[model samples]
Target: MKNTFNIHEVSNLLDVSIPKLLLWEKKNKLVPTEKDTNGINIYLKNQLVDFPIAKDVFESKWDEEIKIKPLGSYNSIELFAGAGGMALGFEKAGIHHVLLNEIDKFSCSTLRKNRPEWNVIEDDIKNLDFKKYANKVEIVTGGFPCQSFSAAGKKLGFEDTRGTLFFEFARCIKEVQPKIFVGENVKGLFHHDKGRTLQVIKDTIHELGYTLIEPRVLKAMYYKVPQKRERLFLIGIRNDLAEKNNDFKFPAPYKKVLTLTDAFKKGDLFDNDVPESIGDMYPARKKEILDFVPQGGYWKDLPDDLQREFMQRSYFLGGGKTGLARRLSMTAPSLTLVCSPSMKQTERCHPLETRPLTIRESARIQTFPDEWEFVGPKSQAYKQIGNAVPVNLAWSVARSIIDYLNKINVDNRKNTKTILQSESV
Candidate 1:
């Protein structure tokens, strides 16, 4: 019944050599073990359960803990804001929000309902000119939709990227000329169109006189988010800003991993039990079929005849087909919450209940606080919650940005002093 394991057991389970484990311990890649009076290393068993090594031994080493410096009152403007997930995170990190641009009526309403003081723009981004914010905002952030560019012509430029939301995002960056800019997208952006999509984005940022910081795919689970969502983070420092200092780094990963229980029950994530709310209902036939799935079980748990009827040709295909009729496990993070948690192709049934997770349940899994409410109908609410960046994940990233900005400020002061002394000489 014990979830935790010892260091030796972890070494054996991971098939990693003792020397490699020692190296990991030294590099801070593995959890530091407690030491006895005799200096013997002892690791907690539960810590090993969610360690990255146990999940995928070949996983990259990008999940190191990030240190963040607190920078108070740093001004920021967010574009393509959806239900304020990223904005909430930045606020938690002590960043000041000057404006938030969101095109969805429901989402804009949701923002206003929660934080009436926020300057929420409810119009299309293309219609609004950001010239007024020139040299005013310190940071510009957005989660622009990823779209493929025409390959027939030269590499996509700012003009060619027109008619796309990313172009609008780029336009805002140009107009504001913020010291730093952060853009996020799905992991698919990395491989979209043989990687040309990301390449063009980087080139465009360079054209705008900003230095791209080797964009990376940040895993939500690593940052205390209970889902397996991966977001591509694009950070750019204005050329002038980068020349002043180069010590900027991303936020470090949390020491612990969160699970479904963490989201719904009293724990580090939430203080009270999840509030009961309205959710989409399943049809009679689908409900009857889903009733058979046990906690953590999926379509494979159904009767053979039922499997054939439900899966159709997909049953004949390869792999585990894990997502089909999948009931979540309380011990691990919930699978990515989709707009329709009850759909057959991407079912996200409650671990105990036969029905889909409610709108509030979905929001909790994304790290949205209990007070934050979604707007519009049940479906639109689900879409906003499902599409949001995990608020805690955003806080971690924002902390890193604040640290970089502090370093920039310090360097600027030093440079200014040197120029003053030179002119006097």
Candidate 2:
């Protein structure tokens, strides 16, 4: 078997485009071990060890499912629970849900339709009180939108975040006092507000009596999802629990980086071909222009005149504009999905067909089960699916958190036993 990878192979392995690989080389982020006779970059497996995703791909643990049972009846209350991606994953990992709050009626209905037994609350998070669930639930999780806080020269505190959704998330933590909390956000949050926003979040976590784990941005592809979506996850353990135990690690990546074929066709990720369903369609002019783009090709692939016709003013713009008039490749993972597939700035045309991906197809790419139907109009459904965290990715992270909670459970039991023995003595 070939142990070294050429530039093209490395591109496929990393889900990064060839240009991006070259860019990494230019920035000294990725160094090639050697060059082929044709002067193409060739990298040994060990040379890619610095990238966690590359390391996982080289030595995958995908053969085994991450199976972990909840040590106890661990209950969680999820806020901003749009369409239940994380909730479902947490449930699959054996965490029970006490409540799920979402502001969107369509999303709330989708959650209720799938799991009628769940306490799906369709209300503004600000209107709901989490104090009732204090001491009742072990975890509080939310995918809060990142919003900036008004600040002078002074350092921002928990109260300074009051106007943003993150404040609501922190309010729940303060009220519920869960043993652990998880916050999910777009990867951009890492650098938002020139890093000041993240600093405030870190300060708030400390104020709320929890120890925030060094946050990490997890790629969906590494976690068994067939989409190149990236999400930043923040895990915080209550101060008391943090002191009791110190070992906590993120979930390991899968062995194989799944592709569009794994998502749409019968394979390890799914049992059958993606079922047909309604999806958005491109206009005649848009469709005709995109027809010329080849598989995995974007606007640059179009003829000079046609590229000018399709791109108009954007044609003169400086950026690569890679997403415009782009077609997915059957062999690689799909690009991160946007709210609508037909948008010119980020077109998501089907691999073989000229149309946009159907409702079910989009769900599969996000690792949603076939039967896990989205209950709304095509546009609303697309929005729900596009905005969701990949279900498989959530499941992987949830398993790790559950493992940590289990360890804490054991420590608590040991401490109790010791105290009882001291009383008897």
Best by lDDT: 2
Q: Which residue window of length 10 is worst by lDDT in model 2?
A: 58-67
Query: lDDT tens digits, residues 1-425, model 1?
Result: 34454554455445454567789888887754576566645666555657554544223232432344454468999999999999999988888899999999999999999999999999999899999999999999999999987751486667767778888999999999999999999989988988888877877898898999988888787677887777999999999988877777876655455678888998878889899999987788877888888876889999999888878899899688888988887766777778777777889988877788998899999999989989899889998998899998998899889888988777778889999999999
Best by TM-score: 2
Q: Each prediction's Cα lDDT score?
A: 0.82, 0.89
lDDT string for model 2 (1-425, tens) is 25788886678677778788999999988879889999999998877767776877767654444767888899999999998899988888889999999999999999999999999999999999888888888999999999888861266788889889999999999999999999999999999999989999999999999999999999898888988999999999999889888688888888767789999999989889988888878889888888999989999999999999988898998788888999998878999998898888898999999999999999999998988978889999999999998899999989888889999888889989999999999
**TM-score result, candidate 1:** 0.84
Off by over 4 Å in 1: 1-3, 6-72, 151-155, 317-319, 417-425
Error of 1 at 289 (Å): 2.1
Q: What TM-score goes with each of the models? A: 0.84, 0.91
Look at candidate 1 and tell me the lDDT of residue 284.
Answer: 83
What's the C-alpha lDDT at position 60 in model 1?
27
